[model samples]
Target: MNLQQLYYFKTIAQLEHYTKAAEQLNVSQSRLSHAIGDLEKELQVTLFVHQGRNVKLTRCGAFLLEYVSQSLDILDRGLEKLSDFVNPDTGSIGLSYLGSLANFVTFCISRFFEKTGKVQVHFQFNQTVTQTIEDSLMEGHTDLAFTTPFDNKNIESVKIGSHKTILIVSRDHPLAAQDSVDLTTLANETFVTYSPQCMIRNHIDEIFQTVGIQPKISFEALYDSIVLGVVSANLGVALVAEAVDLTGCHVKALQIENEIPEREIHMAWVKDRYMTPAVKCFRDFIMESGMLLDQYKKK
Candidate 1:
């Protein structure tokens, strides 16, 4: 009927002697008899037969013993698996990142696997457009996120590094011959820029305001690659991360003579969530060594 009762029956059936079973179980003979009696009455079956001074298991008792043994074994195994599941040292760790940090993040992932060999890592990429992705972090959809800094009171942030937003121009563009150009030099050039809410757009706006020049906007896009692709076609010059691969795009990254602050990259997570061992190891790994990525290196 219950675990204790089943255990009592199992011990008694194994010994086949009421007195010996009571002595081994450390219970009085009367107490053991009452418990067994209760079980037999509940099951409406005789589980033991008295044969002179000793006892023998009934047919039902032997069958029940086999099943109870298997049931207990399964429960024991389940407990152990549950214990392992809760262990912090190993398991899956979830992370979300901005697509721009791909190169830097991949480097860190290799380092993490080298240090913690057995942990399973999970990762997702988010464009970091609005509160949606940030809300995902807070709701436990991800344990960590690499993204542009934002004002979110529920999130905890760590400054990893910043990337210079360089000017990408077509190979045939007039300014491509120059090593660098001032922001004012592009004042009359139709610019390919990201959406208004994009952090890169904000930086460009700040530079324009500081130099007292309004950029002549020609095209706007949601993604940096599209903006770069357009610039490669000579439609216009665009500002983008210095690390963006311009290989087949036929674009060149040029430094800016006028001051334009680098776009910041940060690692953020929910403010007070419990970090598992795998997550903690990864978080510490990034915080301690993330700045060394070449994309983050200042040229």
Candidate 2:
């Protein structure tokens, strides 16, 4: 039977009186009876039997009632979830970003939550490399990314801010004593850098290439923190974004005498994917806050 008939059946089964059920449902008793009669005729089973002025479900009716109750409950929950999904005040967002942007993302999220008091937006964070972030967006596994600009045509990006490249060397390293050093002088020094798959690695490679020298790479790590850790042990020197936290690492940051392009950070998403209200809320917040650049300036 149709959903309406099933609903009527459930209501009648619960109340156990046709007149009362019809009144609660805002329908005529005869209309309710005819609907149930049609349903029983379709199912070829007597659903109810008179108990004086009241009605009691038949054996078959009781079994059907159990299934109908479960099905209706499931449908009601589904409807509720759908409403929440579209509502800006509540929903979930799949957010991905580079490990280097962890602090910035945290600040943005905290501020966003503060601004939207009583909001219930949940974030699923994926800290990954630029390539994987792009793939996730394309595959619909991720809704937004704080990363380097994607080269894919299917991905759209907005430049959020830039990070000045800096050099990190061990505390005891000779260059650590210098206020600034030229890249040409470090041509023969061992370098600790991100893996080739990482977007920051590509930027580092470009800088080295621009200086007309190939750095002697001694170590490759996935994240900036790992690279800094390697440099702290005097394993090798590293070029990394200035935003990278130098808190616990015993590495000295140095300014580059040589001109280098700042590492650009972007907020990227799939070009043609449906954005949930939560996703839009976050994306818009970041875009409007100017917090990215403000944080960089504070640094």
Error of 2 at 140 (Å): 1.7
> CA shift at 43, candidate 1, in angstroms?
14
Model 1, span 1-299: residue lDDT tens: 77878878888888888899999999999989999999999999999999987888889988888998888779889878655544555445666665566666677777777877744555444545434557778789788887777687888888887777778899989888987888886668989987875656787777678777888898998776788789989999987777666768888778888766667778888888888766787788888775654434543
In candidate 1, what residue range of length 10 has the lowest lDDT sum?
122-131
TM-score of each: 0.69, 0.90
Reference-based lDDT, each prediction: 0.77, 0.88
- The model with the greatest lDDT is 2
Residue 141 lDDT (model 2)? 95
User: lDDT per residue, candidate 2, 220-252, as tens digits?
Assistant: 988877887789999899998887889988999
Q: Candidate 1, 245: how far from true, in Å?
A: 2.7
Clashes of each: 0, 0
